[model samples]
Every structure is written in C-alpha cells, then in structure tokens.
Target: ATAEKFRSISPAEFFYRNKEIAGFANPARALYQAVRELVENALDATDAHGILPNIEVSIERDSVKQYVYRISVKDNGIGIPEKYIPEAFGKVLFSSKYVLRQTRGLFGLGAKMVILYGQMTVGEPAEIISAAINSRRIYSYRIMIDVRENKPIIVSKGVWPNNTGWHGTMVKVAIEGDWSRAKQKILDYIKRTAIVTPYANIVFKTPDGEIYTYLRVTETIPPPPRETKPHPHGVDLELIKTMISETKAQRLIDFISEEFQGVGNVIAERFLTKYGFDPSKDPKTLSKEELELLVKALKEFNEFRKPRADHLSPIGAELIKIGLNSILKPEFVDAVTRKPVVYEGHSIIVEVGIAYGGSIQPSEEVVLLRYANKIPLLYDEKSDVAWKVVSENIDWSYYGIVFPAPLAILVHICGTKIPYKGVGKESIAEVPVIEKEIEEGVRQVARSLKLYLARKQKEEEMMRKAVT
Candidate 1:
C-alpha cells in the first residue's frame, strides 16, 4: 500500500474547503444562510442586553459583477468590544455563546463563515462598525480571515463620532450569490421570524429596491434566560474533570455543592459517604480510578432533585395567541405552554399554538411552523421530531380537521441544550421525552380548536334550517 498522506489544517482552512458544514453548500443557500446567521446574531445580542431589537438588513447587487451582492446588517444591540472585533468576525470557532443558557447561535462558526465565504469568492474583507453600550465613540474595522493561521488580518481601522448616541453593530460583506433564487426563502424566513418574535422591529431592503418592515407588536420582551450550574444527573467524567479543574472550592464536598445543582451540604456529604470518598479531601487530587468510581456512583444516585428549568426562557401562551392573531388572522386561535420536562438530564419546555379558519389558507396538508429556542426552523420539516409527533401521534380527523383544512400548527421548544439532529440546527432529534411533550402540548390546543369547529357547525346547521 502507498504511504498515507495527511496534513493538519486550521479550523478556518477546514471550513473554507468544506463550507457546506456551515450551510453554505450552494450560492442560493449560502446567501440565505449568511443573512440568517448575521440576523440571528444581532437578535441574540439585543436579547442578551434586554434591548428591543431594531435590526436593519439590506441586500444590494454589486455594481460591476453579476450574481454578486453586498449584504449589510445593522442592529441596535450590545456591540462587540473594539479589541475583540476582528477575532469575533474573522476567526472560526470563536464565540461568546458557550454558556449554559438558551441561545439561537450555538456554534461560533456562523458570522465568520460568512466572511470566509466572501473572501473565497470576491476577495473582499468584511467591514464592521460597532459602538459598545454606553461607550463614548464608535469604532470601525475592515478585516479578513487568514485561513491558514485561523486568525484575523485587519486591513483598516477608524473611529466615528457617536453623535446620535447609538450602540450596536453593523457588518457588511460582498459575496458571490444568486439573489433571484434566494429571494423567496429570505423573505419567508424574515416573515416567520417576525411572527415568532413580535417584540422585535426588523426591516429588510431587497436588491430590487423594495423595502419591507416588520413593526414590533408588543413592547414586552420575554425574560432572558439565566445561567445555571449543571445538574448532578447531567455530569459525566469529562464534565467532572472540567469542573474539578476550574472550580474554586478546595474540598470535594464544597465542590459538589457549588458545581452541581440540586446538591446541597447534606446531599453532598451523604453522597461522599456512600461513595467512600472523603468529603474534606481535595477534589482535584482524585485518581483516574477514583474519578470513574465517583462518576458511576453519581449516575446510580437517584435522590437528587430534577434540574432547574428556570434557565429556559419560553414564550408564554398569551404571547403566542397575540402573535398568531397578528400574523395568521385566524378566527379561532388557542395556545398551550407545557410544564418543563427533562430529557437526558436537560430541562426543556414546549409551547404549541393552533390557528383555524378565517384567512388562513386551506391546503392539502397541515401548515407547520417549527421553532427551537426562539429560532425558526425553515428546512427539513418532514424529518424533525416535532413534525413526527404532529403527523403520527395527533389524530386530526377526530377534531373535524381534514385535508385542505384551514389550519396552522406552531410548535416551539426551548431548552438549555437542544438535541439538534444536524449541524445546521434545522431539526430536533427524536428524543422520546421531547416528542411526548410536543404531542401533549399540541393536543391541548387542538382540543380547543375542536370545540370551536363543533360550535361553528351547529350554528351553520341552524342557519340552514331557518332558511328552509
């Protein structure tokens, strides 16, 4: 056999060559994905700082090049600090969203990939303008990615006067893409985003010079999620090792109580005693054998309370009703917010909404809108776990619903850790606990729709009798 040839590559180089992993498989999809990644980042930044999102997105054709467009997104959000701006936008796998909280952008590869794609096609660096919240001045930088080194190369830097007293970020990139093919998906994605996040104000200026604005329907923003300690049930050997390395507590007992949720002084001491580990010993000194034993004991222990669900920020039922009414204009609308459920030690909450009759278009199949952690899932609908639960588990016939029925089903799952089936984050895996919660939540709203339909049929029957 010939000698194998192999070489190591930086994260940037790897993704530069395999752009499909970041959802830039084709020109059309790449354009859509780039816009989505930036918009989602802007929304996340605004949400993190408790600011009502005022995001502006524009797509304009390149002056001299066909099928090339300049995409710009500006948001009134917490801007990136000046020092970290280049790395944040140019380096791959660098992100600030690693905390244990609900977030739209899971991996740090989104915005950087957009810049890299642009560099590969158009040889243009991304322009970034940012003014941190409460800062005195705004800073701008033109930067590009050095794929070989996985680093940012700043081309230019400047400062601007903050005359308007604004705080946010603006990013501009020129990329080779097919706007004609991506226009519809881009518009639909924006519309769906508006429905789900009625509190955000978004404007889109297409390449055709047409501008669309989505006004905020409510001033009330959902409560932001809070970070929480990992639950004891969720901890594995790797996590335990990480905790030991980073923990401030010197004693094993203190470490247990501080690092893991639902573990208090009493429980910690008891656990240590049961596992034959010394409570007063240094947890960092645990041998490999001892660590394995501790992990096994913890997995077997069933006395700990379930993980806290407060880390999850789910959209409530009333807001769901308002959103559906505003967007779908359905005559009858109902929603349900399920109680928190645990899946593999992760806390998850499911919210479902049903809209029937009155302006909602009838179709041969049910219209489904799926969301995870407030981010809309636009593709791979059929394979999603939420779709599976809605199609296979729910009986639409019993509720007087049939093909071409005027109905819309909305399902949103919020959690600290979403079990995504793929890197695209477009679908949820079929975890039994998650599927059951979705089915139950949908059923609750479906019952309300059924009653409304039954009453309407009765009224129609009476009207026909009176006419006779």
Candidate 2:
C-alpha cells in the first residue's frame, strides 16, 4: 500500500522538487548540451530577423583554484520580447508551434535543463541581457534557484547601466566545473556548427585569449522545412488512451468520430471492426473486456507516414564554403546540391555534397552525417560501414588521400527513417535496402571528385611541360 501510494504522485512534480534527479554524472556532457542549446537559440534569433546572423562567443576562467569558468554567447539578431522571458527561461517541457517546421527544441526543454544543472553544480547563475530593437532599453536577469526547496530564485534584474543601447541578446553562464575538457567540446561544437551553418559569421575567444572567427561568405540561407500537421494514419493504444483522456468529449466512439475527421475515422472504424467492436455502439456503454479489445486493436494499427517536405532544412551552401575554406585553406571551394538520388530498389533518398580544392588533406574531411530526422550521427569513419564505399571504392591516390592526409567531405542523408546502430547514437546499422543506394550515391560523389582531380592533374602537367 505504501509503494502504491508513493507511485501515485506525478513524475514532473517529483523531479521538480528534486532538480538533481535529471542526473549530471558528467558535468562536461551537460555543459556541452547546454552550449548547443544556446548556440541554436542564437541562430533562431538570426533567422527571425530575416538577416544573416553574427555571433561572438568568449570564455574566461576565474578563481583559479576553484576553476570557475564564464562562457558568453552574444548575437546580433532578433531579441525576445519581455513577455516570453519568463516562459522561455523558467518553464520546462513547453512546445512552441509558432513555426510548423520540425526543430531541435519542440519541447522547449533544451536550455532550462542547463539552468537547473548550473544551479545544482555551480552555485552561481545564468545571466541574460537583451533588447528587442535599436532602443536603448535592455532587460537583464540572472536565473538561479531556491536550493533549499528547489524553487526558482531571481538573483538579479535590471537594464544595462552603460546606456549604450545594444540591439541583441547576450547570455553569460558561470559554471564551476573542469574548463579544459569543456573548452575542447566547445571548439568541436563550433567547428561542426560552422560546417552546417556556413552562412552565419561566428567568432570565438578562448580562455587563453586565442580567437577563431568564421565570416560569412554568402548571403543565401536554406529554405525553411515544411510544417507537419497531425496525421491520423497511426495511433497506438497508449497514444489513443492519452488522446481520449485529454479529449473534451466523454464518449470514446464520439471523440474518435468527431474530434478526428477524414482518415482518422476510417482508421478508427477499421481498428474497431478488426477487434469485433461495434462502431454504432456508444463507447461509454462498453465493458472492461470490450475496452481491452479496443486497445489491442488500436495497438495493431499504429503505422504512420511522416510528411516528406517537413524533413528538409535550409543548409546554406556558404556554410560548406566557409568550413572547407578555413580548415583546408583551399584556393577554391565548390559545393554542388544533388537532387534526391534514387538508388535502385531502395526506398531511401540520399542527398550528398562535397568540397574539394587547394590544400584539402585526407584527414580534413568533416562529414556531417545526419539521419533522416536531422539528428547528428557522430560516428567515426572506421565504425560506419558507409565509409567503406568512399575509401575503398574511390580513387584516393590522386586526391592526396594517402596514409595520414586530411580530406574535407560533408555528407547529409535523409529519408523516412534512419536506422541507427544503438542508443549510443553512433553509426547507421546497415540495411540491405539503404546500403545499395548509399553505395551508388558514394560512387557518384567519387566520380565527381575523380573528374575534378583529373582536370587539376592535367593542368599541372601542362604547366610543368611549358616551363621546361
């Protein structure tokens, strides 16, 4: 009875009172994810302004013995309104659908966990200063918690005292953790981010006063992905139960028939008929056995099709240009957008691009291997079977892909579903269907690279002959 009673309380409430319940076995991991959340926010602010975004990041170490580190990200983009400040900073598990496209933060829970983690480990706070436009007014606040009770505590609130009307948001975080490991992670994140978001100008200042800046080379931003409306093709029993429980209508059949229209009714009717349910009968009159049968039927009918256009995101060609240009310092960087490659007999659609020229060494390839869902698949080439097609099948000798040379390649893959190896979130598990297509895609990329290399070789040979 005690165990049953203890389980009765809500999980959210339990975790709310115990912030540490989220777990921070490695503060660096948490901090890495936290910085990702902030950088994404800065990008979103830029997109909102209809202008190319510029961001500056700085890291400083303080209180040497304690190793307190301050990391700040400043963006010249569209700043948030005063009304959204509380909800954006305080709340957890909030979904914003103001824009319909699929994004990394649909739950709006990305950075709040950061704030909670900071309050737990650092004993300091996260600070934010911002203004919506060119106005001299700036709203600043520090986010903390009432640690004794695990409640939110506002540490500071004010406008910028300098009176120099800055027009963007600056977020400063002070963390009491190991800065060395965190520094490497931040650098890697910026490098990867540059490859993906080539259009944005990025500047990073490290704790040692070293700076790395990537300036935008192009004005184009990829087109926004299409929005997804609720589809009725699939609804498992658990999902159906939640939907029915939250629905305004009392009768189960009534809610299924009325609340869900079009394909939803058809699916519901099919599910009910399969399980010997009577569509004409009111769901409230059903017995426990009948309800159980309904749930089983619904469970069997849960296959869904995600909208395709909703999968695409605007990846500026400039991002590729800037990344390869900086890393390889190539004399020329050329990026080609391939139409969706249809591999024979496979349902998977592979879209790929590559940059080659100047001093691109074999080790310099920064392949942004993403699944169809746009989640990062951060696996090394050796583990991923896909690399086999690129390394073995392609002509590497001419491309300078010798023992330890650097190569710069960015590959993005998308489809209805991307099968991953495991929860470790490493490589894509090989499926016969997708593998064949990916092989073909790699062949095409290899052919392009080979042709470009051939041209360069011929030109160099001709020049040498002329000099002789």
Candidate 3:
C-alpha cells in the first residue's frame, strides 16, 4: 500500500465512524446497556422524590418477522416536562445526569444510544411515551437517532388523551438481534441491581415468556452520597497546566494557593523543595523554561503516594447500614466503620464493617465487594484480593458458607484510582500493598471472630463439667 493510504482519516469522519463501534460484536449487549441506562434514569427520578421506585421491564418477541423483538422498560419516576422532551429524547443526548458523585450514567447517552442501536439494527425508529404529574396529558413520539448524519429525526408526535393522572416514561425499541447470547448477562445485571438497590422493586419479562420479579420487603433506599471534589494531590501535569492557563491570577504562587484549595504554603514548599525551586520566589520573574521545570516537578510530586485517609471518600456507615439491613435483615446491629489500614509498604485503605450475631451463617454472613470510589467491581475471584483474603481468613465451618446465603461481609477498597485487568469492571489489577492491607484487615476481623468463639466454647465446657 502507498504511504498516503496509511494516514489517519479526518477527525470528523473518525469520530462519526467510531460512534458506531458499540454495534459490531453483539447488538444485544448494546441494547442491554441501553436498558440499564434508561432504568438508571428512572431510578434517579424517583430517588429525587425520596421514594423507593418500582421499575418494570418487559421483552416481547415480534414474530411477524423472525429475530425481531421489542423491549420496554417502564418506571414510576418523575416524567420529563414538555419543554425538555426533545432534549431528553433527541439532540444533546449525552449525560442527562451529571453530578460529581459516582453514578451509573454520566454521559447521559444511554437512552439515546438505545435509539441509535434500534435504528441501525431494524432500520426503524423507537417509540417514546412520557407524562408529567402536573400535566393533564401524555406526550408520545416516534424518534430515530441518525448516527450516520449526527441528527435526530422526528417520525411522529402526538398527545396521549388520558384524563386519569399518570407519571412515568415508557420506551419501546424494535431491533433485529437474537436474545440467547444476552440472556445470562441480563439476568445477572438484574440480580446485582436487585441486590444493591434493595429498596427498588424490579420486574422483568423475558422474550421466552419467563417472568422474574425482585421485590423489596423494606421501604428504605440508600440515599445518594455527597459529591467528592478533585483533591490537589490527585491532579496531574495537564490539569496544572490548565489551571495556570485559565487562571487570571497575577502571580503563580497566588494561583496555586487560591485556585487549588488543598495546596497550602507548607505543602507547596515540600513539592518545590524536591525540584530545588522555592515557592517564595516570584512567579512573574520566572521564564517559560523555568515554568516548564516547575510543572514537571509538580507532576512528580503528584505521583508520590498520599495517605489513604487524606484522599478516600468511602460509603458512609449509615448508607452501609441501610444496605446491610435491607439485605441481611440484621436485628442487633453491632458496629460499622470504614477505616484505613496499612498492609505492606504502600498506602492502601480497607473499608471493613461488621454486623455480627445475626440469624444467619457466619461464612455467608456479610457482603464484601471492593470498590474504587463507589463503583461496584463484580467479577472473578482470582482478581478480587478482598474476596481472597476474606475467604482465607474467615472460619466458614461455623457458618456453613453457601452461595445465595444470608449475611454478607461488605468490604471495599478506595484508592485514588483502581486498576482493572480487562474491559470487565469486575477484574482489577492487584496492588501488593493494597492487597496486603486488605488481607491483614480481614485477618484482624477474623481474629476477633475466633476469640469470641473460643470464649463461648470455654464457658460452655465449664457449665457442662459442673453439671456432670
């Protein structure tokens, strides 16, 4: 091939072409992701009302043409207003939900992407019907997202004549794809969703006519945690450069001190000391070359491991209590603490909590899933060092460890960033120090359990001996 053929395509075409990458392998998987996005949106809506939500999903096989099916997910959530309907279902489709806290949908592209996938596979537009509580009517629209053209085409729009009040969003998509390959993952997603969102009731109907429903016996849903801002130590060279460029500060030291909240004079001095640069020195006097050297030194300082306590924002004790109580139904709550513990030479923290003496198996007594930030890492055991350590340390014989058992040990890891092994969010690369910290923490908790068991055994033996 000629050298000219090896050149990269124009950025415009590259972006447009790559946008369709979500469809190549299995369009069913993409549909699944889309369904999750819409469901998450619905959940967020109801969550805003501080009410536990009821989300319903239905799959129907349209046998008019083989391999054609319609999937619909409806929720009792706050419906979109008339003015924002077009934006919700059409252009500006990305990131309908935006917050600093860890959430499922950031790009707001989930529901929109579903429409795109539907159009691509079936060559037909998807249907949307939504209504607000205050509105007297429901609005229905048939919409198609033209990815090839980068525009949303409106096929039809009408008002649903419903005198009875209603508030919810219903999206129906017709797509040409087989459902067999996507069955297991859909089931697992529902299961995990049900497990984590213990208060949200979910119902699903498969294409095969199998009906599955997850009902919450409790009325409590974990409130969305507070948002976390970017700490000064976590920002890299590019961020620092951006800060310098956008900031209107007359002096560099003032910019560093005022714009960045955490970097005080002492921390700034420590950072500058390594590069033999003094923070007290005036930034205006420095040339471009000197500024470059300062930026490089700051980047190196950012790489140094900060204390885990200084950086981590773990899920609070109250939220964990809400989750544990809903799942385990614990009667006598003992203790819950999300503390940092040292493992090896590295700085890693393990969020370990206990809900002991429950009416359940000790082995399967609690839930333990490691999280980097607040995202769930659901995957293989080998990659889950937290799982490995807990399994190794806990005495399973006493509790009769079993799958789908009652009681769970909820353990998570919060680092500046978590390293994943592959595309799967479940498998994570093990940091030796972090793993050591986690294992040691598990062992310590296990030791407490062991001591409690020993003491009980001794007391029982003494009573029996005295009676005999």
Candidate 4:
C-alpha cells in the first residue's frame, strides 16, 4: 500500500470523484442539478413516447438541517421496468440516451447522478415508485449507488396495489443543498423549459411555501424521433473497423450499404471500384493499412447523400410561439424552425423565437434563452455557439432590437449529437455549421421584430399628432 495506486475505475467511480463534471460543483449547483436532472429525465420519458407531460417538482427544507432538503419529482411518463429500477436510477451511465436519436438527457447519467449526490451528502438511498406503461402492479424501491463498484445496492422493495390504475414514476431524495443560492436558477430553468415544452403542465412547489404552476398551453407534441443508422461521412477509421467487425455482411459492398445510411448497393460498388477495392472482399479481413485507405477513399468519394434528419424532433414554430406568448405575454413574438442539416454526421436543427415588450422586463443587454435537445442551458451563455452568433455576428439595431428594452431571444438547437464545449452541457461548441444555422434563425425572427417595431412607431406617431 504505497503512495502509487493502480486500478480500473468504473464510470460510476469516475463520477463519484469528479462530481463537478455533472455540474454539482457546490451545494448550490448540486441542488439545482438535482432538480434539473429529475425534471429533464421526466421530459425525456414523456416526450419520447409522445405523451403530454404532467410533471410535479417539490423541494422542502429539512427542519433538522437548514442546508439539507428533500427534493422530489414525479412525472406522468413511461416508467422503467421493475428489474431496471435500481441501476437505471443509481448507476451513472446505464440508460437509453446513448444512441442516434434526440433526447433531453445529455448523458446516460440522468437521475443517477442526483441519487449519487444525495447518497454522498445525506447518506440516504433514493426512494423510487414506478409502474411501467400497460402494467397493473406498481413497484417501490429504495436504492443507493455503490460508486466504487458502479452498481446499485437496493435497500428495500415493495409492491403497491394498482387499484387506481394510474402509471408513472416518482423519485425522492434527501440531499444537502444551498437553496438560497440555487432558487433563482431552478425557477428560471423551469420557466425556460415550460417556454419550449408548451404541452407539459408543470407545478413547482418551492421550499419557501410558494407555488409556481405553468399550465399546458398547447396540445401539440412533436412526433418521436426515429432511431437511425449512422451515415458514412460521420465515421472514421476506428468506427469503420468496428462496423466491419460487427457487420453480418461479408462482402465490402454489401457491408457498406448495410451498415451506413444514405449508402446503397450501387454507390457502395462504385466507391469500391473507384478506390481499387475488391467489392467481393470480406471487410473483416482488411488490415489496418487497407482500412485506413478505405476510409480515406470514403471521404474522398462525394456521391453519398446527406444524412436524413428523421432522428431529430424539434419543437415546431407554432408551439414555440404559443409557449413564449403564454409565458412572457409579449406584445410581439415570432418563431422560426429551420430545416435540419447535417453537421459531423449528426442532424442539427435550430429554432429561434423572439418576444418583445408587454410583460417582459427591459434589459441593458439582450436576454438569450438557449436550449439543446429540449434541455434549458441556463449557465455559460457566452460560451455557447448561439450566443456567439447573437452577440458577435448580428447588428441588433438593424433588427430594431435596440436594447434597454423588453426583448428576449430564444434559441433551441436539436441534434442527434450536440457539440458541447464541456461535459457540463452548459455551452455548445462554435462549430461552423451550428453558428451559421443559429445566425440564420435569429435573423429570421429579428426581421419580424423589426416589422412589429415599425408598426408600433407609426401608431405612436399617429396618436401624438391626434393629441396635439
């Protein structure tokens, strides 16, 4: 047992030591993160299934410990199966979000991180009650994560008779938190989420005995995103090698067509022939050099169609407008949903909404509401690609957005894979394609704002003339 140590740390253990990576840097952020993780998880579950979301969140201050609070979130969504209840909520990276589809969770460690944080701070297991869709019986369990082992240790289990015939999931945990510091962020997160998710009816009860309820403003819910095959352009040498090994097709031509989207038999054969590759050759038999050469050729060949955006589900323009007007009661509002485009093989769609005047408070600088995959990113605004486009690229006066005004711009970027600057998921990388799309989206709504401002000025001038 010398100072030097060698070990294989599991994913859960890595998170245990590096809790800050999940935005639990302090008591304040940890508390906000707990609420965020739970709320986002609820949104993912319900939205994926096209179920209108009914979410409830409560944080109560513990009398025994001023800084410790009981945090709970209950949602009407598809519940986890009985067997997966423990690991799904206790393990760090054991969930269904790691695929070629859109979901609110940035990483597989959703509610599990909350459970781990609670376990470390309050030494309490998370209490979970769940009933899967179409199931009759309800299951209840108290589970804790063994961070070192990277698994769940179930403390207790029971069954609740389903006499009422309702189904969903409820999670409760007691954790140390700085409520005074985290309250504003938590409230803003909820409000922003409501603005984007207009179909969800959310009721939030604060520790201060205040209740903020956001009622559902629209019945429209975007269709569920479809799981898609990877595109050829989205891969590199290692991915090609892995695909070659896993592919059932023995021939290189068949393998290419079968494994990758937008690649067909004719295109695969043409690519193979152009690269001087044997179409009949087994891809698995290719050496490292051959594979590298093949990947180089794949990139060079330009006939492959762009990746289909079927896997991306974006909140439509109408829904975004409804959500913004309902929440902000803005005097003017306009929203635009951009068609999806490929970026690094992932589908990226940008939606921008602008709300002006009315109930919105005037600000010295432009208020930016940024979202990635339906999750509100309240921190690190300057680092996000959207902010860069708005702050640096656009001329605000041209769009009639001379600030010290009640103006807020909302940017929502939906992608199969988001280029986040950090693991915190607070900021997006300034990828060229993302920047272009964001700029275009903002301009689309900004023009509408300019028109509204022009009309308002005309009306004000007319009123002045009549008064004189």
Q: What is the C-alpha lDDT of each candidate?
A: 0.89, 0.58, 0.60, 0.89
Q: How much is 56 displaced in model 3, in angstroms? A: 2.4
The predictions' CA RMSDs to the true structure, in order, are: 1.4, 6.3, 6.2, 1.7
Error of 2 at 81 (Å): 3.7
Task: Return the candidate ranking by TM-score, descending.
Answer: 1, 4, 2, 3
Q: Tell me the tens digit of each residue's lDDT in model 1 across 1-468.
A: 899999899999999999987789988999999899999999999975689999999999987898789999999999988888999998898988888888888788999999999998899889999999887889999999999999999999999788888999999999989999999989988888888788989999999999999888998888888888888877799999998999999999999888888888999999999889999999999999999998888877888878899878888888888888888899999999999998767899999999988899899777899999888888889999988977889889988899778889999999888998777788898998988899988888888888888898999999999999
| TM-score to native of every candidate shown | 0.97, 0.69, 0.67, 0.96
lDDT of 4 by residue, 367-442 (tens): 8999999889999888888888888899998877776889899999998888987677899989998889999989
Worst 10 residues of 4 by lDDT: 97-106
- 1 versus 3: better TM-score goes to: 1
RMSD of 1: 1.4
* Candidate 3, number of clashes: 13
Q: How much is the lDDT of residue 379 in candidate 4? A: 91
Q: If both were scored by lDDT, which would come out higher, candidate 1 or candidate 2?
A: 1
